[model samples]
Target: MDKIRRWVQEGGTLITLKNASEWAIKQGIVKEKLLIPANGGWADTTATRAASTAPASEGKKTKETASASTPGSRRTDFVNQEHEGTRAIAGSIYRTDVDLTNPIAFGLTDRRLYVFRNGTTFLRPSRNPYATVAQYTATPLVSGYVSKANLKQISNSAAIVVSKVGAGRVVLFADDPNFRHYWHGTARLFTNALLLGPLLNLPEGPATISAEEE
Candidate 1:
């Protein structure tokens, strides 16, 4: 970890895909946050069944019941296993807004890009507005299957983030830019990270130094 940190500090461009980006956030290598669902909304059949079958008490509501009954709390219906599995993106295409002015998006003729996603991972745009090179559109799903819940969460989320670590830079991609070697649309993003990452420069401020230098 220390070696990788030093390398990046000295001027290495680290490009991470999918889980690698999560790992980088966990290791404190980057100052970015993952886009997690409100309550981790995983299906809990056993708990749901237990709560449903439990006898109603005269007083003192159970914690789960109270939470469910609380005002403004989100209520989610229990879905079957097969139906709930759609939360994980099997394979989908989403529309992203690319910053044409940024060097990381250079050579991309279009301001809009269609990217391939096959996982549930999502990234929050950096606090530094300029660091986000690309972001998902308000209604990002272009094609393929994605759960309605996921679609709500993915709306207007960061697709690509670039942060400078000392003289080096780190690029985080929420999904694989090159999937199965057939997604030519987003392949340019991968190439841009390799060729132009070192040249990325953000506004001169403390936000740019939020990664490791702080």
Candidate 2:
């Protein structure tokens, strides 16, 4: 780990995708946060099913009794576990807004690109606005199926983020850019990370830069 950190500090570019990006964040190799779903990851099917199958009359009585007996007991809901499972973004296409001005986006003519997304690994945009080279649009789902809950969570999330680590760089992608060799649009972005990684620059100072200054 120390060697890897040193290499990055000494002008080595480290590119990570999907689960690798998540691992990097966990290892403190990059300063970023994962965008957790509101329900806290996947649904608990067993718990939900148990709650859903209880007698309605008994549930009502229990709730009333609990409310009267315990002043601050949390209320539980009977949710459709099947519906909750739909929140997983199995495989889909989403539109991302690219910062054409950024070197990572060089050779990209369009400001908008469609990318394949197959998992729920969402990334919060960097505090440094300049570091976020690409971000999902307010209405990112371009095609394919995604639950409303998942779509809401993915909206405005970071699709590609690049940060300067000492003299080197670290690029993180929320989804596989080179997925199945069919997503040519995003494949270019992946290539850019390898070819133009050294060109990525951040303002010298705090990690975050306000949009107003730009």
Candidate 3:
């Protein structure tokens, strides 16, 4: 992880997915948490599930911190939120917003992009200038069997998160675009990240942007 941090400080881009997203966010690279169902069927632990539905607290605190333990001596701060998960939501078609202007979003056409199994995390307010390159607009349903009650509690979250860590770029995905070598709609996104990720613009300033995962 330290080596990875060094690469990023040297202007390298780290593209992470699924459980990897959980790791990066926890390390402060992405500023969010990748959540998964505590059990195979349920979305998350009871506490996280409930907190996921509660409205964003107006009084939530935002703080900043600086650390030079790493290579570039990056300083960052952002509000973090506890998030829940939907049953993987595989095989279901969902539309997410795409920022065409962002280089990381290059090659994607149409105002929206169709994807399968967007199990990524969401962001809360933060000082990091991260951007939501793509986000879910509607409640997501489990691919085969999910309760309406569960879906109703789902929050429209970022399907794709882009930010600069030190001199490098990081792209966080809810789930792997290449889940099983069958889902192809979002493969371009992964490709774009590999090709254009390093060139991704750094956040101009602090902006609103997730949680600890087991």
Candidate 4:
């Protein structure tokens, strides 16, 4: 982890997704942790079952009690990221809300994208200043069946975050844009990241320290 951190600090670009992003945060390569919190939404069975069958007395349980203690009952939060496991939101179509003016959004005439077996990811970056070039128009549904009604959108969450790390750059993708061979529409977005990430002159943030500084 330390070696990787040094590499990133020395102007090496890092493009990470899902578990890799989560691991980077934990290792201090990135400062913020992103997690899909345990809730009734998506494929969280514990949250669903608890909400459906638990009595009023169980509702009054302490935070410690509600805390993730079992495999099925574990919270999907970043702290329990490895616990709840990744979900595949099969056959879901997402609209990409893009900053068309941004260079990273080049060649994108349409905002629609498709996903197959897409995982559930909720990102909240607290330690770095990043520009959101694109985001899902709606909260991503993480199950075999995609349903718009299952999502509860929050204004601050994003699907992509681009930031400068030292002299290089880092791009964090909450979910896989290219899910399978059939979801070829999102390949352009991924290509944009590859071509534009290093070119991005991101605003200064805690993670933007110069390579010569330390």
Best by TM-score, which number? 1
Q: Kindly list the per-residue Cα lDDT of model 1 for residues 44-82, writing each as its tens digit.
A: 122333454457772236766667766558656666446
Q: Tell me the tens digit of each residue's lDDT in model 4 across 20-90.
A: 66555445565444544445442212243335446777665744575645446744667755532333343
Where does model 4 exceed 4 Å of error? 38-88, 111-117, 125-130, 138-144, 147-150, 153-156, 205-214
Q: What's each prediction's TM-score?
A: 0.75, 0.74, 0.63, 0.61
Q: Candidate 3, 92: how far from true, in Å?
A: 2.7
Checking candidate 2 for backbone clashes, the offending pairs are: none
- Among residues 3 or more apart in sequence or in different chains, the pairs in candidate 1 whose N, CA or C atoms overlap within 3 Å are none
Candidate 1, residue 34: lDDT = 78
| Comparison by TM-score, 3 against 4, better one | 3
Scored against the true structure, residue 62 in model 2 reaches a CA lDDT of 64
Off by over 4 Å in 3: 33-91, 118-130, 140-145, 149-154, 209-214
| lDDT (Cα, 0-100) at 126 in candidate 3 | 28
Residues 26-98, candidate 2: write the lDDT tens digits. 6667766676533345321223234445799867876786577662365556674466667677899998899
How do the residues 7-92 of candidate 3 rate in per-residue lDDT, one tens digit apiece? 98788888888667656766655544443444333332224333434456621321112132332355344332122233334345
Tell me model 3's lDDT, rounded to 2 decimals. 0.60
TM-score of 2: 0.74
How far in Å is the alpha carbon of 47 misplaced in model 3? 15
lDDT against true structure, model 4: 0.57
